[model samples]
Target chain A: MGKNNVEQMILNIPSDLKYLGAVDAAIQDLAREFSFSPDAINDVSTALVEACSNAIEHGNHFAKDKRVVVTLRFNGGDFVATVQDEGRGFDFAKALRDEAGPDPMSERGRGILIMRAFTDDLKFKCDDKGLTVELTKLRGGGGDAGQ
Target chain B: MKITQREVGSAAILDLNGKLTGGPDADAFRDVFKSLLEQNKKHIIVNLEKVSWINSTGLGILIHNYNTVRGAGGDMVVMHASERIESILYVTKLNLLFKSFNSEDEAVRSFTAAR
Candidate 1:
C-alpha cells in the first residue's frame, strides 16, 4: 500500500491571468488540509501563480485559444508543482535574471525571480517539449533530502 | 482578504484581513490609497492585525502608496503586524520608513495625536 503521503492532482485552465485567483484558492485549500505552514503554503501559491502568469504572457503569448496545464504533487514531505505551456521553449537563465535585471517599478519580468526566491528549486526544462517551470519545496524544509 | 472602510472623525480606517496579494483587491487597494490621498488625507492608519501574508507585489503597492502619501506630506501608520510581514519589513528596511503600533486604537490615536 502507498504511504498515503504521495498524492497528485492536475488542473487545466483557459490561459487567462484572471484565473490566478482561483488557482490561489485551490492551492491554499490543499496546503491547509495537508497541515502546511502558512508561509510555505503562501510561498508555493505565489510562485505557482507567477509561473502561470508568465506562461500565459510569454509561453502562449496570451492567445485566447491556448490552455495552460498545472500539475501539483504532494509527495513524501515535499510539495512540488509544474506549469507547462504550449509555446516554444523559453530561456531559463534569462527569465531568472533578465538582461537588464528588471526595474523594481516594472510589473513584468520579475515573475521568475520571485518564484526562485519562494521555492527551493525552480528550473526551466527544455528538450524539444516546451517551457516548463519545475518548482520544488519541502513542505516544511528538509530540502527533499528527508524525502 | 477582507477589507472594511469606516470613517473615524476625519480619517478613514481600512481594516484588512487574510493575505494582500493579487486578485480583485490589488488594483482596488492601490486606487483606494490614491483616492484617499487625492482627498487630502494626510493621515492614514492601516490595521494589519489579521493579515496572513503578502508578496512582493503587495509590498510594491504599499510602497507605491507610501511614496504618494509622503510626497503629499501625509504619513501612513501600520498596526498589529504579524511576525511574517514584520520580518519582511525589517529585511527590506521598510520598518524604518513607517511607524508601527501594537494595536488598532494605538495606531489611529497616533494619527490624531500627530494632528
Candidate 2:
C-alpha cells in the first residue's frame, strides 16, 4: 500500500459483549495488513476492545436497541480506530482523574488507563449523537508494546 | 471463559480457558470463587495457560476476586499468564499486587511457603 492510500474497515454490532471477538478479529487482520509487529497487533487489539467495551457498557448501557460502530483505518504510517456509541456520554476526564488515585485494588475503572497506555494517541468526542473514542497507533512506534 | 477447579494439597486451582472479559464471564468467575470461599478453600491459584485474551474488565474481575480471597484470610496467585495478559497487568501496576508464577507447582508452593 502507498503512503497516500488509506484502507478502512467498519464494524457494526449491537451493545453485546459476545460480538467483541469479531471486533478483535477485524483489528488483527488490519494490523497484520499494515505489517504491525506481533506485539503492536496485540496492543491495538487490546485498546480497541477496551474502547468497544466502554461504548457498549457505558455509552449504550447495554440496550439491545443501541448499536456500537467501529471504524478501523490505516494510512501506511498509522492505524486508527474510532468506536461510536448511541447514548449519552459520561465524563471521560473525570473518570480518568478518579482512576488516577494510588489504589491498585479498585476493580471498576482501569479501562481508559489501559487504553491510554497501549495506544499512541487517544481522543474522545461527545455530542447529541453519542460518544466516539478515537484511538491511534503509529506503525513502528515501539512503544512499550506487550511490556 | 471455562473454569475448572482442582485441589492441589490445600490450594484450590481454577484453570481458566478462553477470554476472561466481563459480562457473563465475570458472573461465572464470581460464582466459582464464592463457592470456594464457602468451602473454606482460601488459598487459590488462577491458571491462565489457555486464556487467549483478557482486557481491563477481566483484570478487574481478577482484582475483585483477589481482594475477596485476601479478605477471607487467604491468598490468590496467578500462573501461566500469557505475555499479553502480563503486559496489561504490568501497565496497571497490578503485577506488583498479584504474585505470578510460570508453573502450577510454584504457585501452589507459594501458599505453603508463605506460612
Give residue A132's lDDT in candidate 1 (0 to 100): 84
Model 1 docking grade: incorrect
Q: Quote the positional error of residue B56 for candidate 1 in Å.
A: 3.5
Q: Give each prediction's DockQ, rounded to 2 decimals.
A: 0.17, 0.68
lDDT of 1 at A30: 82
**How do the residues A63-136 of candidate 2 rate in per-residue lDDT, one tens digit apiece?**
99999999999986599899999988888877766545347988877888888888988888998889999999
Model 1 per-residue lDDT at B47:
78
Task: Give the per-residue lDDT of model 1 (tens digit) for B1-115.
Answer: 7778776765577789877665456787878888887788767877788886665556666767777777788878788887656755554446766788887677767776887
Question: Which window of 10 residues has the lowest lDDT sum in candidate 1 chain A?
Answer: A138-147
Q: After superposition, which runs of candidate 2 have C-alpha atoms over 4 Å from their true positions?
A: A1-4, A96-102, A144-146
Question: Candidate 1: deviation at residue B103, Å?
Answer: 1.3
Query: What lDDT score is found at residue A18 in candidate 2?
Result: 86
Candidate 1 lDDT over A7-109, as tens digits, reads 8889898776667777788888887777778777766776787788777767887788888889988887578899888889766776665533355433334
lDDT for position A26 in model 1: 83
For each candidate, report what fraction of the true interface contacts it reproduces: 0.04, 0.70
Model 2's C-alpha root-mean-square deviation from the true structure amounts to: 1.7
> For candidate 1, what is the lDDT?
0.71
Pairs of colliding residues, candidate 2: none
